[model samples]
Target: MAELLDNDDPRFAFAALKEYAANSGALLRSHIEAFGFSGLETVELDVNAAKGLGTLLASKRYAGLVLDRYYAHAAAKWLAAHPTLGRLTERAARSGAVDLLLREGDGTLTGDDLAQEILEDVLRTHAPNLTCRTALILVDPPASDAAAAQRERARSLRASLRALGIETALRVVDANRPGISLPEAPAAEPDLLLNASVFGTDAVFSDEPLFCERCEAAIPSENVEPKSAGGQRLPEPRLLVETAARPLRSHLLIEARRRGIPAVSGFELEVARARAVIEAFLGRPLRNCVSATIERDIRLEAENIVLIGMPGCGKTTIGKILAQRLMRRFVDVDELVAQHVGKFKARIYREEGEAFFREKETEAIRTLALKTGLIISTGGGSCLRPVNRALLGLNGRFIWLKRPLAKLATRDRPIAIARGVAALYEERAPIYSSLADRTIEVSSIDETVRAILGEHA
Candidate 1:
């Protein structure tokens, strides 16, 4: 981090890394394993290491380093405990003390300034207009220390809100309880339900956690059938703020939006730390650009351009073009599957079976789903699985490339060959339609690309 701060150029820092490659290689591998990439061989270090390092060092703005979650959380606790210091920093921010903090790098100013910055963003529109007029912060910690820490964090937030003349109450609840209901309701529903708990972070297992998409009812994950999906009921408030970092459209947020509620993800609030750091470094306040940079980062980190359609519908072709135009990494799921199996898609189907091919496809999708900022082209039938659909939809914007069934080339496409092109199209078209966030009719490649770009813009 210091190296990057000194140079302010990713290329220069990366070159320094290569100079100390032996030491950096072991250090990088340890961090990589910590992020869940295990069993990495030393021989494949060049390719895998470069990819991992590039992912972190590609942007010199260094938002992730500046907006460190640990620092922000620590700052919140500090502000909660030190009311005098908090007031001083609040006055400092109001008086443009950017120069003091920038020149001194004082820890005292940094923490309070960061906490105040986050508060400013959150209260931009002021508090909610509910009868209760008090926000409820729900916390469920896994340990005693965690409980204490969460209490401090909540207290910090309460202190910040009090400064703005808003009232907040923190409640420690049991997460395993079947239903989330308050012991005694206020005059009306709480102004906001601040989910500082870890309940919704397990969204992948439950699919949703507020309301079912199809039935519009609260159904727990265990009670639903194997293939059926539903969500559990959460205490509703005028607004929901989840404090854990999640994808832009995690099932928790999706369910909230489906139920006509406004939700704020953790990613939105994390900008405060980065905003504070950048402003300190620049020696001036940024009126704009921080949010804009965050929005762009969202596009890069969580919103992928995913193309899906029948085989030979130009998904791969259009995906390549889109990848180049957008300057994103391109991934063809079919190619990834083939690489995993050491065989082509056609050969796999002919030798092993569709079931085996499908397994490999799911594996590829699962791996790719965990990443972001890619133009992904999926196989014709790969997305038919419910799991695959969920995985892709987690971090991607699906664009169905619609070409005439007759126009689709079927060369070496085993499924397209086995089932006639018309039959395959008829079977898969509805799924494509269901999953598509945007659909582009494949009249002209350039026109289709333009439509996708325009929609994104």
Candidate 2:
């Protein structure tokens, strides 16, 4: 039995004793007597009795004592009998490395709920020592929604631990499948196992040996059976003393910490709370990491200054001026669309149909959106499509160049000739208004350039 015990360290032995006692509802004195340390009650409160009890608890027999709950109470008594042992056990129990194993079952509780409950239980059961230490959260993947919620909860739990200065990691197990292999060795070995599974009985009976081998920690489960694989006995892992939660509320601050950003949740309250907590912990203002990332993306995306309006609205002339003033390359989306279809926009509309031309236009806009620091001039009806509007918005500051209907150029414009400038303007005015970040009523190219550059500056 002594050889069968996983850990030889007296501190782990004592902590295991207390855990066993708590679970089995056994008395500590009984375990001490069972371990062949008799007459503890009769022994006087002197150095000799304390010495004897310490030696016995620290002996090889103490290892065997942790293997069975029958010896748990006596182990607890051994700790109580010696003040130094009791204190040492308490500290080890609190600060030691903990591995949590969660089982999957037909329970109404979500994975997150189960995780919260188990974490709370572990923290409450083992505190101070368990606080600010590494924890590995393992659970069987649940149903789609439940799994998503569980991942979210795990993310929150990680954040909460970081807030408390604890390092944490998460892993999902397929418990129903046998011979599940770990991706890689864990960063650190755990000191204790919290088996929070519905199939707790089966896991303890069949899996304890493997778990003990990998973790060198005691399984805090009531069910236990001898390890046998294909009529062959298995050996336990090397045990040593050197080894090694809250409702894990996810505040917005936790999300920000995870993203290395500020205001990730987008809700004012959550962002405020996250900001305050992070600032206090970091002892400085929360850097706008998210904003910085977006700015970087914008730079990469090459968001150009885009001018849009009807054909005769002086978009080309104004676009070139704006480009020169801003020292950016100028591009005409209409020309790009023409190049894509291997013909002019009017020819594509006439030959292939308006739908094909619209597709070409959309493709051109998407390509243009990937460019940065440019001045773009768009055709009359580009803002009509919601997709084009969205794509352009992502990479450009949109400005609609508005001109009176009578002055609009309809000579080479097929759409203007077919639909008439007044009708086109009436039809697209609302879309242009909706899409443009800013609108400049066109007076001249110079004035328009100033307005656009003023906004840019």
Candidate 3:
């Protein structure tokens, strides 16, 4: 066995254990016992040894391999408590390769009917190609007449699935009975496993399979918008499996890791979280992808219509008309600054200084850039600040509303009155032209609106 092992070094003793287990068809406990250690103390195993054991167990060679009763229970508990293991279980369940729901409970399945309905709907919409095969595994079956009632409900669930063209099966197990055990993975594995029973029972410990809780009738919750797959309306792919016991959640996660499945903590499994798991499982993007696509469509209709150039270029008048025609929100950057400072723009510049006004103007532009579908009228010097220019450039389609120097507004405007329109134009014309997505020479307010609307259309 030593010579047959993959690694020759004694430091890799688990390599030898792997070779022995592969060839001899012995359980993991036997190998651990051979090494003079109780398999119950699995935590004592080094990280490499633990990983090696998990790898060996997951391999096809060791398929259907069973652990000793004590070791099996211990390993199941350990695996259930693992943190990162849940991700793999989630991945496998959402891959669209399998459509299974495993419900483990006593004879009475409280929410089985609702789960069946949801599963049927999911199959009809998103997974039309796949069969919805469900397994109702009854753990700790009740005594006598109650047992008969449980069987009836199971039959009803089976019938429901059948109506939807889903194959269904019912397995009754009495874990309390001496020597009897729960079914192992691969043989009895389902795509979605619902642990309706309390944790640490025979059902949860029996197989290292992914576990889910009862389905919420209104899952995907109110906040989540339904998405479309294959041109069919589908509820967001989310499994709302509730488990109150933290240890049980951990145990299921551990089983997922051992079996190379993705699992998420039931408490953390929201619509968004479930979508993320599905994305990981399918190896494609979902909600974010859909959002990006929608945003692209909106940009076509509502690209930021930014009006730029000299102070009296009729930007505010044209902006109002364009926004009304385009059905977008109208925003004047100078007005935003006035609102922010609780004073008029001229007052702010006179009392607080030109620098103070520019700071407020820049803040308004930065804040407004986060939104879309707007016609923005900016102050003459708003483009002078590179920060403001960058922020506006990100979301707005800059439109230079150019005007003759004499036509520029000089009355009541301090910059135009002080610097003169010719000086302001010399300084700002190049920046405005460089930044403009479209340059429209100002003729009349109606003409400007028509030109913008034509270009936008």
Candidate 4:
């Protein structure tokens, strides 16, 4: 099995994960079976760490090479000489998979070229059975030369798709343009949207901005305001492919999921490429599905759990319990508002009024939405505004905790007290149902926790 990489060493993160099934618990009472895997280990590394990659490759034990688009061409010359890969290339030629060989250029083949090659290979190999007829390539134009290069790349991609019997269209947009409106789709909406844009990839990872700062100036998602052309909403593509590896950091990915569009992360493509190379080196297929497992693991570790419902529906209580059990930080939007106001929620309602309290709530939610891996409990009325809903829903799985109105504790909750429990429930029930990703009845607290865990598991 290929080993998982540590981020500290540039070569550490190149593992092709294999799933193995094993029986547990010897002849015990009611022999229970279970699944297990190693934990993810994330370490930070810089561009200089690429030196370690060369040193590691010299060891010869690591035959497979999978690199980021930016670094692919940098090591292409050395990679072309791999004895195992050379043998595999001969086999691939005999089998008529001509593109299997690593193509070289006169030091002109760039990271973009390698990325395009990988994209083509992935389409030809894995999604060969796809029935999608239309594709749109959205480019983020930099300089005039870069823009032209991107256009040429898109044209090449279009030709590749055409060879696969899929008609494709190209759409280039200025990612920097304010209030950018994407061009309307043709008679039929595009089946796939290939975001070759820098929207997600340009942002600086604050903790590790040494590399990012050398590229483009960082743009926060809050600054990007993309709207559909005209007054109507842009048609959602069936599949969205972000060329950026870190989809979680992208606003585009968040918006895509919220609109029910299926997305493919650029990292998935990298993993697929790595898996293929590793399988070739091993001379046998690995017993694992790359995309689904990686996607699930990333989501399970990074996504936030949000509890939203009536004022006294046990969101806070259950959220605390869930957070403790799952080992995630617990955040209460109500407490955030109170912390900002320097008073209790009811005091804020009485002294500063509801508008002031809501403003604080929105500010808090906006900040928290940018973070990940938290268990959040919202103020009963916090998600009433669409912006709040968007902020929280961007990275959270909202769960509605439903309980009998009479059973709810309404002592300190001014809103629930002023507005009768029945009346408030009648007003907010529909919104809760609409916004919740999962709805769990508040039976016993333990049962409710189990239900939430089961949903996530």
> RMSD of each candidate?
9.9, 25.1, 26.4, 10.6
Using lDDT as the measure, name the better of candidate 2 and candidate 3. 3
Tens-place lDDT digits, model 2, residues 196-301? 2211122212232223332232222122332323221112211110000100111112212323322111112222322232232223553477434433433322
Q: After superposition, how far is residue 296 of candidate 1 from its true place, in Å?
A: 4.3
- Model 4 poorest 10 in a row by lDDT: 24-33
Cα lDDT of model 4 by residue, 371-437, tens digit: 6689999999987766576567656778899998889999899999998999999999998998888
Error of 4 at 19 (Å): 32
**Which of 1 and 3 is the better model by TM-score?**
1
Q: Estimate each model's TM-score.
A: 0.65, 0.40, 0.39, 0.65
Q: At residue 198, what lDDT does model 2 achieve?
A: 19
Which should have the higher lDDT, number 2 or number 4? 4
TM value for model 2: 0.40
| Candidate 4 ranges beyond 4 A from true positions | 1-65, 73-132, 143-170, 174-189, 198-238, 245-284, 289-295
User: Judged by lDDT, which candidate is best?
Assistant: 1
Better of 1 and 2 by TM-score: 1
* Colliding pairs, model 4: 5-12, 5-13
How are the candidates ranked when ordered by TM-score, highest leading?
1, 4, 2, 3
lDDT of 3 by residue, 1-457 (tens): 1222222222111222333343212322233232222222221222233554455333333101222111222233333444232111232122211111111232110111222333345445533433234433333355543244334434444454456554544444443342323342221333333333322222323222112323121111112322222111111112212222222233333334334434433222222222332232233554566534433443444357788989888888999888888788999999999998899888998999997888788778767764556889999889887556655654567899988787776777998888888888899899998878789988877877898788556
Winner on lDDT between 1 and 3 is 1
Backbone clash pairs for candidate 1 read: none
